[model samples]
Target: MSQGLPYDKITSAYAGTIVYPPKGTYGPRMQQDLQLVLLHTGELELTIDGSRHAVKPGQAVLLKPQHQEYFAFAETQESWHRWITLDLASLTDEEQDYLDKLPFSMPIPEALNTMTDMMLALQNDYLRQDELMRSLGYSAFQMFTARISLTKQQELHPSVVAALGYIRQHYMEDIALHDLAGAAGVSPEHLVRLFHVHHQMTPIRYLWQYRVLKATELLSQSGLSVGEIAARCGFKTAFHLSRLVKEQTGSTPSDIRKAAWGTAN
Candidate 1:
């Protein structure tokens, strides 16, 4: 661990992977720090106090400190898991408070999974001597923490939650209103009304709007050209992407690129 690191960086306590044989169990033990676990194979059933959580593969759970818990591996299979532990004392008070609000468990996004795996790779000899590598490890931990924490003011409708996860996972595809409705497990008209109630727009409108938002990020940061970005973002043509960017953001892609970077994107 190091001192005087930036707020966006972290000094983690420990991180590593574990594997358990069938019917194996651990704990009746106590947690010492905030930890995030990513289960990779088989099922995990964790009982904290008296409540039980059944986590599937590709899912993650954030554990708080000071809880008595038991871990049960699948009765008929092995379980593979990866985790990163965060020391609360290493983070600022604001950062500590933010961790308090994360969902106990959630699906791991693809980007977050990559970041977590990268962080775990560093766990063997993490920050033993190199200062810059230490800082990078810290920032990696910070990145996953920020990603897992969904800072909504209120809980969204279950249908909206399902639709949002679907759109985010497949925004590059040519998605239709019916597809969105089907993913949300609602009728097309019902999904539209729900979107209007929550997002103040129809389901289809939100999809394109979200596409424009993704295009803006690429325009401001990625090296991809407008035409390539359009295809990646589900727009029909470069002109279509440009027109929407101009209409929604009051700026052309070129202007955004120039202003965002040093005369380029």
Candidate 2:
């Protein structure tokens, strides 16, 4: 039997590379694939599993599998990175544990600089049609995960978890900080502090991001009009939806539809 090409053997569930331009948002996007994002320049804000992180220069973000990762650049800075789509079967027990503990936004370590260089080089090779580049890329992911696996464990506070849960449930509706504080059984001031300490996002920004994420899914999976989608996602109007979508995804609903279906009727 002949061996399959590496790219060919890349299962639909497998990982691949994605490049983001200046002022780009990779998503209000979620994937089942394991992804390691290395920020080349610019700042990246990642909201994963209802927490927000701002990762700046010389830092990296790991997107955990099945977690919702929504990203937007802090400015018009060009942020570029490579992603490897990986299936659950490929991860070892240790790596799985590491991923479970993460969706981290932290500065890249000096020790991992060598690995980052190698991952970038492999991206170039893969672009140039080198089949061995896939192997190199996988190795780089491994090294990056191994580095994180060694970090000390941090305990999560009860209020933080409650706030995250409330966001996930009520993202499609209008909710206020006091509402979340009530759900978490804390005062509004205390809830705000918990959000800052654990998630780095205020409650309102998290709700906005969550709504945008839901709006993106509706845009992709349903045939709803922009106005309808805006209402469904708790936006005041289609124009508001259009503006926010453009600001976050660099495209309007009509634009996304046109790209997906070739034309918007």
Candidate 3:
């Protein structure tokens, strides 16, 4: 009997798929929302930030908010995926912990088919205006988290935590990789390697992520324009800020402001 996280509610979300086997680049450069991929057939390689992971049939991948992601099929690849996404604010801390332990992409077995089916069914029912589907969606999400929790936990190295903390505190200004490496008391190269292994991105990428996250808060909560926000976030220019935001969030400064306003109202 697994104790699942409590959820206030769950609502049906948009669903879509990308069929492969004959194309050039076909995936979005970056995603703005939470995304889930259910692979039904073939293989797909997903690049989340700078880390690469392979997802196969009977497996799934969940993309967290604000992460940069891209995917491509191998040549002669036969791949089909069923993807759907719901808002991530619905996940509790306990459920999020479970999710963080699992690999970005992992296999799903037939034993969990019923739970997956329930999610699919809820997606359909909720889209069709069946109010009860919300409850079922939340239940299905809890079950998914429980399954991930049953897997072994991966310990975060002390150095990684220290480095993460350093970034969180000092991301606004320019900080060298060697400075972080020295703080962690490891060789610069080793620090880069280890950070990539655990954090799934280079230290610089993490720094950028931290800056962007801060910028987002300022953008939404403060009355800052693109130029002001860019300067505050340590970006050289508004264009640079726009480029980074587009790369990481698939949206520009104006768009983010609009989105913030939309949410507020």
Candidate 4:
């Protein structure tokens, strides 16, 4: 028999498709909340707390709070992943402990297909935001969590998890591969291999992507100019920041700022 979820309500839900650049990557950082991601098409690779896993159609990645996870599309392919973020505080201590013990990735059981479908349906209801629809969405989300709790679980490599934490906390500064390796208490070469095996990129590349992501948030939410944002985000100059932003997002820093401001107003 399956165990029930500790929570009675889902605070929020979302469904969307993300197109990753052929060589692009996202995250090697800790999640602030619990997130369940269902990959509908293509492939998505993730390193959860140093253990690497690949999620495909009908497979889901369950990310617990404070777990260091990073994701990227399979090489040269596009991925369509559905996701829902749950509020961990809503869960009872027992439920939270159960969730914490589950594997990072698992197959979405055939019986739970309906609930997976409901996730997308819930996404629609959430967007509509009508009282009845929202209530229904919450119910569906609760059922989804209940079913998910029964799946198999995976483990993480402690050393890699620690190394990822160090990188995430200090990414805003100039970081070197050896520095990361030292922090992980591993040889520099071994750390590079760990990064490749797990993150699919070198430590420095992961650091760069992390900085760029932070810069994008600042660009959209703050009044800081590109030059200031560059320095704050660890870029050597505005030109470096602009080039990377354009490469990663296909838009210049000025254009991104304008678009963000336009949306805010």
lDDT of candidate model 4 versus the reference = 0.62
TM-score: model 4 vs. ground truth = 0.44
Worst 10 residues of 1 by lDDT: 1-10
Candidate 4 per-residue lDDT, tens place, 47-89, comes to 8778778777778666777678888777776777666565534
Error of 3 at 178 (Å): 1.0
Q: After the best TM-score superposition of candidate 3, give how far the Cα of residue 156 lies from its true spot, in angstroms.
A: 1.5
Tens digit of per-residue lDDT, candidate 1, span 14-67: 557889999989988887666778899989999988789998988878787667
For each of the candidates, the C-alpha root-mean-square deviation to the true structure, in angstroms, is: 10.9, 18.9, 16.7, 18.9
Would you list the C-alpha lDDT of every candidate in the order shown?
0.69, 0.59, 0.60, 0.62
Deviation in angstroms for 143 in model 1? 5.1
lDDT of 4 at 184: 86
Who is ahead in lDDT, 1 or 2?
Answer: 1
Give a tens-digit lDDT track for model 3, residues 1-265.
1122233323344455567873324555666544567788777788878787877778867666556777777567667777656554456676656455544655664423443454454444345223233333343343354345335234666676677678767776678898788778888898889877765568777778667757766765688888888887778888888887655443466655553454311
The runs of at least 3 residues in candidate 2 whose Cα sits more than 4 Å from the true structure, single-residue gaps closed, are 1-155, 262-265
Best by lDDT: 1
> What's the TM-score of every candidate structure?
0.50, 0.44, 0.46, 0.44
Task: Give the runs in model 1 whose Cα sits over 4 Å from its true position.
Answer: 1-10, 90-98, 128-265
Clashes of 2: 3
